[model samples]
Target: WDEEPFELIVSNPPYSVKWVGDGDATLINDPRFAPAGVLAPKSKADMAFIMHSLSWLAANGTAAIVCFPGIMYRGGAEQKIRKYLVDNNYVDAVIQLSGGLFFGTSIATCIMVLKKGKSDNKVMFIDASKECIKVTNNNKLTPENIDRIVDVFAKREEVAHFSHLADYAEIAENDFNLSVSTYVEPEDTREKIDIKKLNAEIAEIVAREQVLRSEIDKIIAEIEG
Candidate 1:
C-alpha cells in the first residue's frame, strides 16, 4: 500500500460466488490485474482476490494467496491474467493441497506465492495433497507437514512426482496452466504387480487342465471299446 511498507503478505482469501468476471470491463483494463483479460467460468472470486494481493505486493515482498485449482489452468480472463504474471516471472510457487482438506467441499485447493522483483526466473510447484492426514472428517495440515512443504519450496529440490521448478517458457508452453497437478503429479497409488507370479499361476492352471483332458480321453476310449 502507499501508506505502509510491509515485506510479506499472506492470507486465506475467500473462494466463493458472485464475483465479477467477463461481465465487467474495468477488470480487463487494470494494469495490476495481470493478463488484461477476464476470469474463467463460475470460479467464484479466486482470481479477483489473487489480483488484489498481487497489487499490494511490495517490490521485493512476497504474498501467498489461497485459491481453488481452477485459476491455474482455466482459459479466458483467468488464463490471460495468469499468463501476464507468469510471463513476467512474478509467480514463485504453487502448492496444491489434498482433497477433503476443506469441509463442505471436496475440491482440492492451491496456494499461489508471488514475489515482486524476483531475480530467479523459475517458478516452484509442490504437490502437497498427500502431505496432510485427515482429522475427524476434514483433512488438515499438521505443523510438521507444513514444515515439510515449506522446506521443499525453500530448498527447490527436484523431487520425484512431488515438486518441480519450471521456467516461464515451460509454463507458456503449457498455455499458462499452473495447476499444481500439471507440474507435479500426485504419487501413483496403483500397486506394483509381479509378472512372474501371474505367469506362474497361469502356467499351473494350464497344466491341471491338460491332466484333466488326458483323463477324459482315457475314460471315453475305454467306454467305446
Candidate 2:
C-alpha cells in the first residue's frame, strides 16, 4: 500500500504484536517510522500502527485510535515514539476508558487522538475510567458518559478528577509519560479517618479495662478472706 495522507483516520489497531523477530530488522528503516527515530519493539507493534497512521494523516485531519494502555507508559522504544509525538505537538488528547468495557477482556483501554495541524502545544487527558455501567459480565458506556467525555474534550477544560490539560513543558517534566493517571488525578473514595477521635477512644477503653481489673482483684481478695 502507498503512503497517502487522508483527511480522517480511525482505527482499533491490534494492541500488541511481534512484527520483527528472528533477527529480521528491515522495519527499522521504514519511512513511516522515520519521525519516531526508532522502531517499536518486536513484541509490541502499538506504536508501529500509530506512526503509520500519523505518516498518512492529512494536515487538516484527525485520527482517533483505540490503544493498549501500555503504549502510553511503557519504556524503551515506545517511550521514544511518545517523546516524538509529544515534542512535535501531534498528540491532541488521551482518554482513559472504563475497564471491562470490551467483551472477552477486562483490560482498561485508552483512546489517543492525533492531529497534524494542532492549534496548541498542550495535550488534554480525560479520566473516563469510571464512566460506565456494569451490565451482566461487562461494563457499558452510556450515551451520557460519552457526551460528558466529548464535552470536556471539546472545551479542553480541567475538571477535578475527570480531566486535565497539560502543556508540552509539563509533559516534558513528566518524562513524556502520557498515562492519564499521571496528569488527571482520580477521586479519592476511601473513608477519611479522624486520628484524634480514634486515639481518645482507645485511651478510654484502656482506662475502663484498668478499672475493671482493679474491681475484680478486690472481689477475689474479699472472697478469699
Candidate 3:
C-alpha cells in the first residue's frame, strides 16, 4: 500500500490467519482500522485485511474479498467492526458460495464487497451456495452459474429464496450480522410426505404379512398330518 488509491481491489487472503491485530495496542490508531473503533482479533486477521484494502480503495472504488463465514456473525471486536462497516454503508454486498469448492476443505465461504461510495444504504446478500456442479472432489461454478450471480449483483434485484436487499435499519436490528443466510432465505427442497397415506401402506403390508404367515402355518400342519 503506497498510499495510492486504486479503483478496484480483489483478494482471497488466508482464512483466519493470525496477525498482530489487537496485540499491538497502537495498531488500532492506524487510520485503516481506526474508523472501526476496534481492531480485528489477533487470532483472526480476516477483517484486518479488509480494512487494509478499504483504506487503499479509491473514492468510487469497490473491493471484493473472499472471507471466512465466521466473521459475518462473530461477536465481540468483530461485531464492532461489522457495526462500523454497516453504519458507514461501506459494505455493498455479501455473497455466499457453496462448500467443497476448494481443495483440502469443504467449508462454505463468502465474498464481502466493500465500496467507499455506495449508491444506496441497502446491502445486497446473494446465496449462491447451490450454484455449483460437483466436479470430482470439488464443486465448480459453471459459466452460467457465474453469470447468474454477476447479473443478480449488478441488478441488485431481490430474488425469492436466492437474494435479499437489506436496509440499514434491518442490519442494525440484526446486530450487524452480514451472513448471507441471515438475509436470503434458503429454498426448502425437502419432499413433502403424507402421514395418512404412509400409515395405510404400512397397514396393508402388515395385513399381507399376517395372511402369508397363516397360509404357511396351514401348509406345515397339513404336511405333518
Q: Score each candidate by Cα lDDT.
A: 0.81, 0.91, 0.94
TM-score winner, 1 or 2: 2
Least accurate 10 contiguous residues by lDDT in model 1: 34-43
Estimate TM-scores for all models: 0.87, 0.91, 0.85
Instruction: Indicate which candidate wins on lDDT.
Output: 3
Which whole-number lDDT from 0 to 100 does residue 75 have in model 3? Answer: 99
lDDT of 2 at 32: 85
For lDDT, candidate 2 versus 3, the one ahead is 3
* Tens-digit lDDT string for candidate 3 (68-102): 99999999999999999888889999999999987
The true-versus-predicted C-alpha distance at residue 147 of model 3, in Å, is 0.3
Once superposed on the true structure, which residue ranges of model 2 sit more than 4 Å away at CA? 1-4, 21-26
Clashes of each: 6, 0, 0
> In model 2, what are the clashing residue pairs, if there are any?
none
RMSD of each: 2.5, 2.2, 3.3
Ranking by lDDT: 3, 2, 1
